[model samples]
Target chain A: MRRSRTALFVLVLALAVAACGGTASLKGAVRNPPLEVGTLSLPGPDGREVTMKAEPGGLLLVYFGYTSCPDVCPTTMADISEALTELHPDQAEKVTVAMVTVDPERDTLERLDDYLGHFFSRRLPLRTEDFDRLSAVTAAFGVQWEIEEHEPGDQAYDVAHTALTYVVDDTGTVRVEWPFGFSSEDMAADLAALLEEPRA
Target chain B: MKRTSCRRRLAIASVLVVTLAACGGGSGGLEVTEAWARTSPAMAEAGAAYMQITNGGGADDALVGVSVDPAVARSAEIHETVMAEADDEATHGSDMGGGMMEMRAVDRLEIPAGETVSLEPGGYHIMLLDLASPLEEGSTVELTLTFENAGELVVTAEVRATGP
Candidate 1:
């Protein structure tokens, strides 16, 4: 069963790459299955074990990047913030942005906290302990991470992963993930449409 | 005498047109307005600032550089976010980048007139290098934006409090 699942993941990953302009492959490869968003236990930047569950009552936007990421991570979130500004203050309430770290090795609770601070004044930190854990969760949603190469035993790296930001609907299903470089207007429109999805 | 007078007027008119065109967006003649800046915390070795670059006057204006309290930071520069890639097109990180995927600059940071320029995290931003001291929240830092032609405009950046 595991071999078949791995083969399927490989196939999907190949296709995903094709659809993604044949960008670089995702590191810490996982089984790219549709994520079943639900309660999961993970340590947050606060160092406390945080049990986060999917609330179908609202829309969640998720991304996987490390804190030290020079640009891609921050730029993507900043874009999301801009799109949020376009949303009605009331409707914005129904949206939550979740960024999980791939470099949990260095993204200590303190580091994660500091990293998230640049994005959301109130954004809580999301961190994982093991690569396998991150791999499993990210794979479940087809999130890829291919950390760039460097020196031997070196931790610092530049990563190339799926640039698409994930938008999970209230039902815990991966909804549409707006590709990188979506205009602010288009992002707002898609988000509004998703927000108005018959509130489950 | 008449010919010389006409040439002088034409030169003056040309200068005016060029200046006016630049006073807005690019030479493209876009209207610009609603410019604001966020102040970095003073005393901090480094800080960041943000603003809204509305192009009500033009199509778009690209922010290339900034000048701030030299006393506050050794240098102020513009930064655009981008993902790294390798020459073989693999992800470059701690182990890769045999000069492979170099971190490329963002195509452009568009400042559309009337739209707020949110240079927050995960977006276009100004990096303040070498701060004089730590910037405190609620404090304001004076920022001067030198545009291509619209000239230079100084703004106050408001520092917000956050966990260190």
Candidate 2:
């Protein structure tokens, strides 16, 4: 009886180890005691104060960009759109993408709505002219951005920022950070895996 | 007098040959391929175009300017997206938020000899400013690329729903 019990314990230990190892294969890092970022209150596309929190039992993907961003911003949005398209209809419905504009001076609410409408219709386009408020929100999520002024005669400037997509769990905790350049298939897989996890 | 006239004719012929060579007239020239553009969002006033440029000749080339149809866009310019350097530590946290990203207009993009320069997303691209109309998916736009030595190369960029 003693030998049988020891064998059973060893089998149980092995299974536990295997289960833990499964999460290691995930494309995005799994946060332990996930990062606590509070709710975001900003101006929505309608120029009204809107509060954004992770869905009660869903996922929120947040990105920082501008309407005039010619390359990376659009590319990342396209990737997210493709990822949602690849998911099951029910699964896709649980995901929401909220894009906050770093260039609020030019990215008006109407401009943002027109820009985001290209990739997905369900996105939350937020903007603010207050830099301090924008700074606080970015600090919470560890996002970075800066503006590059053009020459005296030039009509445009550039805003350099971190190109990362933060995946927030339903409980308003950042669960994963998707870097730029990830494929749509990889993004979809990560989202699916996170959705399967029980809310913490 | 006859000898001097013959020398003058030779000088003129040499200048013509040099001009032709500089204009990418021979077997060695610049080639552009795999041109494409993403479909603009509804009501968007701007769009972007991407392509790969290859220099087959021995001489170096520079993409000086780009032009689109007046009906398609009001103006077009070259732009590059770059990551912000992580040097500042005062305003932003060292671990979470420091690197800021931005894009700026570029006057020229150089293509070295026997090398290929790709204008893909998250890198170099053409910014179509003030679009006359939204870019429809499955459509094509005509673009003319002007180079310092290769003159002009025209291409039809397909507007895709997404990107390549």
Candidate 3:
């Protein structure tokens, strides 16, 4: 009887270890920065108001730029799109991309949808809304933007804004921000790590 | 012999006048100010760039073409944005000019002197073709501008992020 009891204890110890290992939390860091997001009502291409709200619900990856931007916006957006493409189907499903146009004058709902669509071939939808809400999102996330005045009457007039990407988790707290100009591999690794972390 | 010498001097004076006008030196007012350009990131095969070419000189100047590192770009073309001919003002036409915007390469641009001919966003711009890599911010791209009169103007363009 003593030998049997000892064997039973050993079995329980092994089972316990296995259970703890399955629940090991990933070491993903969330931003401790304060956030400031306000509601905005920008018109979509369909002529509908694409209202944006500060939802701490699902994961949010936010960036601020115009569709007319030539270099950095496309690069950043392309990198994100490629990283999303590389993720396993399950991992890809959980992530969401949100773009805000500082130049709402041009990056209308229609334009944002169209611009992001080019970069994102996947059916995974990207959310875009008005400048105010977008500005609020950036402000809350500590993103910076300045209106760049070019020659008058030039529609190509663009805004010089920050090339930063923010990651917000299910709990709606800004978890991390990746600056502009990240290689596809680095972005993929960072995103994968975030996905593996335990739910907050 | 004295009369012959006078004729020779007159011919020389005519040549000097022609040279001065053609070269645009000291009088033609080849003014270039606020000139800028941009390149895409990740070494795009083709990218659009912009600049402001302000000629304070009281005459007109033309930007014929631009030359950067030949190894980096095959050729840099001057481009202007025009409404996509097929574009309709209404409907959910998601497809417009494919791959960014359609940049019609411009062979020449007339910058009226005494006016700031700004080639900024939404205006005339220099398109940098096929980059070796993305134009990293703080990295300056060497550009050589050839004018109709000013010959070649060598300038360094600071590569910065669109919104940084």
Candidate 4:
């Protein structure tokens, strides 16, 4: 009886280790206490207010950027699209990408749709002119951004914004955060691993 | 008269040598390589190009100006992306609050002797403004870079979906 009990204890220990080790090897920065997605209802390209949600066992890739951004935004969008291509078609279908434009003044609904659709077909274009609501949503995700003051007709103005990408779990909690310069291969690997993790 | 002719021939030969050096012949000179630009999305008014400029000669050089055809873009300017701290003080203590990236126009980019200067993403780049059309993938755009010493060099940048 003693030996049997010891064997059972060892088996239980192994199972626990397997469960915890799954996400510990992720390439992104894992959030200890993940932040909630929090009330991000914005207008999609179709002129309808859409509330962002994460389905169980699925992933949400959120990025903050604008259409006028030439360098960082395009590189990031391409990387995400490439990462999705690296995943299995079924796994890729389980993921959703949403880009929230910090510069709504320049990023109209039609403009955002055209820019984002070129990179990934499975994407959501989130834009809002209500600065107060935008601030609340960005604050929840710990994103920071600023736009240069310019005249109404000034097309050369610039916007200063963060480049961090967030990975939200099925619960709408930010599970991992990837900073600027993260490679597409690493992102794909993280997505595969996150998909395998069991939802709580 | 024969001796004078010989001397004049030598003078002409020396002048040829000087002209050869100035034209970047055998002597090491500026070389631009690996020039590429990311494909611009449809309706995007601006785009950026990146490359490495190597000053192989003994004297330093500076890239003072850049130009592209009006069909490609209205103008090209050298710019640098800088990281600025976010204004949200609430997230100040957290490392996840990555700072904001800002791009500013730079007047000159110096290429020191025997050094290679790279213009890459999140760093120095050539900002193409008022693009007449979207830079399509697999297409090429021509740019003329004016250097203080190396004169003007025409570089063709291949457009791709991502950076190299």
Candidate 5:
């Protein structure tokens, strides 16, 4: 009976270790396991195909916005730029910031390039081939966007999109998501912590 | 003797008060402060300006219209960026799922008596549309804001690369 009880205790200890090793908890970040976003191929600012995969051995920071965004989009980009600036040069290089435009009709490749150039250099301006493709890619990350039309005679319109910044690990699993008003310091700290985690 | 000195002191104090009032006091007048605009890319067709307007007098004021140089833009108007209600199903873990964001033109923005109206990002702003040329950073644009009670106030807005 004593030997059986000892064996059961050892089994419980082993199970607990396995469970703890399966997931890594990040500060100020939501742990989302099994969140897989497969490889994405989109047009880069250079008009060439840019395929984004998790095997690149760096974290991917993806944000969705348009070039004509007068406020939130620019603010978020600036925040990301500042956050990257706070990181060490090598650590900053380990992270990639990709901005996917929802307003494909208005945000041409050249225009997207111009807008992103104002904030940071090491970034990707992902342009959609078409509306359908854009929808498919955004749906994979649970992003939602809509184009709000103006009055019947007016020619102006606005694209309303989700403003969250998704952080995906090197293995294609989403690890953290920063909401609209998240600070640069928090993002920098989170990225640093994620960088320290051992690769799976 | 003491009474005479007190009278002189009162006279000097009254003069100082009058001078200070003349320098800054505007009863019921609209004051514009911290006016600024974000720089637009060379190909951008529109830009936005933000500012704070305060009514210093006892009466309320309304921002009626905004006018800029014809060379800067074809027209300028007041616009409010609001987040409209989003679909229930789409609201799951979505930052913007709570509302559908949109910018709409408004006729006027009201400033209550002795109250301040802030025109900032994700809120009220002056939309400069049909830009003749892109607004460059480090440049300043002249804006003419017409108020219902404060008349027209001309303010120079510095073009910035980022929002506050």
Candidate 6:
């Protein structure tokens, strides 16, 4: 299975390169059987419980990280922000970004809001201490997170988590998944194509 | 003499452009270049700074400590983002480079003689904790870096929205 996936990835990479930024070619990894993530009721901005759903004819981006992360999380957010700017105004407006905090103990809803507001104006800060709900969501998205045990008063405990971003299309299906270190230009191009091109 | 002077001038210019830092002092100790920090939002409690530290001296050096100006942040520590080894079964067949990643404080970053060590995103970095104020774009923050051999050297890291 690993070998086959690797082969497919290489083939896709070759095709992407050959196409040379052609329309309908996505830079991210395309989910063969697109993941269906229907509406989820979670705590959203302004302390409101909102139904998390992709807008019709739009896209939804979901990420998992903590605000205290000084390195990777902020970098990814900045890249996403940059990518959105690269998109056409119409396409950009149709996108929604939602972030789930893996370190709920340290990441208050207010902190998440503040951190996400820096990059994008339209942001959803999802945080819940309920392990069952969080686990269900993360497991469905194939995200894993582990918080190191530390003293109760210690605020320096670190969290280990998956660094993948999922892109949900208008149909509430995860069409593509971007890995860590995905460039903003490529992301922007993929997003544009996802919005403009008809799915094969 | 004219040829030697011209060659020296060319070398200096190259150093300026490539290193983005002043030429090494008489001893050619260490040069910190391309130092910058990403701008933080108003309520951001933490930030990070990145740079390339080149040891031009014959002796090796180590970046042992870091501290931000109190006005910029309450404290600073050298950190490294490491990909935690995940259960093979969990990450298997995932093409998204999906894995567990973590960050931890790094005690020392060694720079061998004539070697450049980079403190960059997704790698070694200077983690700023309890940011006193938002690192505004187009602004600069002063950082005091202490090395095993170079003692303490101050560098102004320009605030940017992204990596340099």
- The prediction achieving the highest DockQ against the true structure is 2
lDDT of 1: 0.55
True contacts kept of each: 0.11, 0.55, 0.04, 0.50, 0.26, 0.51
Candidate 5 lDDT over residue span B35-149, tens digit each: 9888876777778898988888787878887878879988788988776565555332243223345677899799898888999877899988878898888889899786765
Give the alpha carbon lDDT tens digit for every residue of B1-164 in model 1: 11236776575456546655665534343332322233332222345555556555544565544667766556565664444343333322232111211233333456665554656443555655666665555666676555544445555666643211
**Candidate 4 ranges beyond 4 A from true positions:** A1-21, B1-21, B24-28, B87-96
* Candidate 3, superposed: residue stretches over 4 Å from native: A1-30, A33-58, A122-134, A150-153, B1-46, B49-164
| Count of clashes, each model | 49, 7, 17, 0, 2, 0
Q: In lDDT terms, which candidate is top?
A: 4
**What is candidate 2's lDDT per residue for B33-135, written digit by digit as tens?**
8889888877666689999999998989898878788799887888887766755642332336335556677888999999999998888989888788888
TM-score of each: 0.50, 0.82, 0.47, 0.87, 0.76, 0.82
Off by over 4 Å in 1: A1-41, A45-53, A146-159, B1-164
Better of 1 and 2 by lDDT: 2
* Residue range A79-104, candidate 1, lDDT tens digits: 77777788998777777777787766
Residue-level lDDT of model 6, residues A150-170, one tens digit each, is 899898777788888888876
Name the regions of candidate 5 deviating beyond 4 angstroms: A1-34, A45-55, A149-155, A198-200, B1-28, B87-99
DockQ of 5: 0.20
Better of 2 and 3 by lDDT: 2
Candidate 2 off by > 4 Å: A1-23, A29-33, A45-52, A149-155, A198-200, B1-28, B86-98
- Higher lDDT: candidate 2 or 5? 2
- lDDT (Cα, tens digit) per residue for candidate 2, span A118-160: 7876778888888888887887778877755556655355567
Candidate 1 has a DockQ of 0.09
Q: Is the docking of candidate 4 incorrect, acceptable, medium or high quality?
A: acceptable
Ten-residue region with minimum lDDT total, candidate 4 chain B: B87-96
Model 2 residue B10 CA deviation in Å: 28
Distance (Å) between predicted and true CA of A114, model 2? 3.0
Error of 4 at A3 (Å): 5.2
